[model samples]
Target chain A: MMSKIVRTMASFLILFVLIYGLYIIMHGHSTPGGGFQGGAVVASGVALLIVAFGSHSIHRSLLERRLSILISIGLLIFIGLAFGGMAKTFFYNFLVGSPIFGHIPPSGPNPGEMSSGGVIPIMDIGVGLNVAGGLSAILLVMALATTVMEVEE
Target chain B: MRKIAIAVSLSIFIGFLIATAFLIHPFGYPPSEMDDYIIENTQSETGANNAVTAVIFDYRGFDTLGEATILFTAVTGVVMLFRAKKKREK
Candidate 1:
């Protein structure tokens, strides 16, 4: 466990970290960051919590099984979206002209739109989920392993 | 003789690196024929303002899929390695 000050600070800071990460993920199609980067950001927050509270306490709520399931769900969403465009060709932007997320920006420089980018935004969310879950699970397991070693010692 | 050979090889490798660095394209001006096409058509075709995202998720999605798979495999390996010991102890 960390000092009380660190724990308190981490708890307070995780909310902003989560929101910023989600913003990056959601605006991936218009911004600089995307799924992997945003997901890494979210995982860093989890790392902060792990460092503050120790793995055992975090593990009680965020189990490896749950994380694994989250990873699976993300993979499924991503692959399903990919397959959805298979009729045209794999990874086709099938939603380009559709009513959903189908607004095309001007040819030149302009401000971006949220409901644009067809399947890109959805794929961003999926990859973000997968990356967040996978990274957090790895960190938690490693922390738990180290704790076990310390106990043994 | 061995020391001379190692020095010669190291210098040769360093020289090759320098030569390649000088010969490489100037920054931000890659010699890709597809760049113009992607830039011109990305907004209309993919409906995305960010060309990079359109390329990754739409044009070259297989790479992302493979990357996700690699991450999944890594997590599985890590969990399996540690979970077995924990189960045995309990």
Candidate 2:
């Protein structure tokens, strides 16, 4: 556990980090940041919480099983979306003309549209979830291992 | 003799690195026709304003799949290793 001030600050800051990360992931189709980058940002926030309140406490809430399930779901969503376009070809942008996320932006510089990018934003979300879960699981396990080592010592 | 050999190899490696650095294409100006095509048609074809995202998620999705698989395997391996350790302790 950390000082009460540190814990309070971490709890407060995590919300902003999470929102920023989601923004990056959702706007990936029209922005510089993408799934991997945004996921890393969110994982960093999880790391902050883990550091503020020891891994054991954090583990109680963010279980390994839950993270694994999250990863699996993300992977399934990504692959499912990919297969959705199999009628034309694998990984086709089938949603481009559909009602969902189907608006095509005018060519050249523009403000960009949220309802654009077809399957790209969805894929970004999937990949972001997968990355966030995987990285958090890794950090949690590593922290737990360190605590175990301390106990052994 | 070993020290002399190490020095020769290190010099040779450094020389190769320098040669490659000098010989490589200028920054951001590679001679590839595919880049032009992607840049021109990415908006129309993929409907993504970000060309980089379009390329990764659409033009080269198989590679992303491979990357995700690698991450999954790594996480599974780590979790299994730690779980086994915990079991041994109990």
Per-model TM against the reference:
0.92, 0.94
Q: What is the Cα root-mean-square deviation between model 1 and the actual structure? A: 2.1
Q: Encode model 2's per-residue lDDT on B1-90: one tens digit a residue.
A: 999999999999999999998899988788989988999988888888899999999999999999999999999999999999999998
Candidate 1 matches the true fold with a TM-score of: 0.92
Candidate with the greatest TM-score versus the true structure: 2
Writing each residue's lDDT as its tens digit, candidate 1 over A76-140 gives 99999999998889888788888866877777677634438889999999999999999999999
Query: Taking the tens digit of each residue's C-alpha lDDT, what string does model 2 give over A55-83?
Result: 99999999989999989998999999999
Off by over 4 Å in 1: A112-115, B1-11, B88-90
lDDT of 2 at B6: 100
Q: On residues B1-90, what C-alpha lDDT tens digit does candidate 1 reach at each position? A: 999999999999999999999999988788987988898888888888889988889888999999999999999999999989889988
The global Cα lDDT (0 to 1) of model 2 is: 0.92
